[model samples]
Target: MTDVTLIFADLAGAAPLVMVLLGAAVFAMSRVSHDPRRMVRVLIAIGILLFVRLSFPLVIPLLLNDVIGAREVQVRVLWNALFYSVPNSIALGLLFWTIFDVGRARSAEEMTRA
Candidate 1:
């Protein structure tokens, strides 16, 4: 395979390990009964963030090669900013909200040991 393919291959190869790590994170989060709803929100949002990151190297290259008209780097850049960055930013925002939840200080208090 070509070098470009190798690069994507590397990303694909590492995906399973990353997925396992994320799965462990989700499992750990599941054990937290103090704030199940918010904890799930945090995990789901983080998982989306990770999924988008993982899909990018594999999907964008393929899209540029066969599906999309634009070239690889340029189109992926614009697409990254549009499709990828948006959701990524939103995921981060949701994660922040789920963790802090300014309007729900009482819920945050449930997490305290005191």
Candidate 2:
């Protein structure tokens, strides 16, 4: 294998590690309280992960010549799907959360008014 191929394999090998870290970050963010600090952190983390995830497929092919490596091709495909799917799913989730939060806030206001 050429030097370039070695580098490509190295990066492809690391993709799973990056994805696992992203997943862990999301899981940790989900546990955070509704405080503004926590929310900001979560949003920032999500944004960064989303950007990276979206770009990974594009970068992967550039890093490798075959674009169909034995071990990592499936990962590339899955990430490509996830890159397209996550934004809409996350938007829906946030929308639901917002609706629930607003409803609760309004209910609390009504209780205070009573």
Best by TM-score: 1
Q: Which stretches of candidate 1 lie over 4 Å from their true place?
A: 1-5, 9-31, 72-76, 107-114
Would you estimate the TM-scores of all the predictions?
A: 0.66, 0.30
Which regions of candidate 2 are displaced past 4 Å?
A: 1-54, 60-79, 107-114
If candidate 2 were superposed on the true structure by all CA atoms, what would the RMSD be? 9.8
| lDDT, candidates in the order shown | 0.71, 0.58
Q: Highest lDDT, which number? A: 1
Predicted candidate 2 versus true structure: per-residue lDDT over 52-111, tens digit per residue: 555554565554446545357677667557655676467446545744665446456766
Clashing pairs in 1: none
Predicted candidate 1: what Cα RMSD to the true structure?
Answer: 3.9
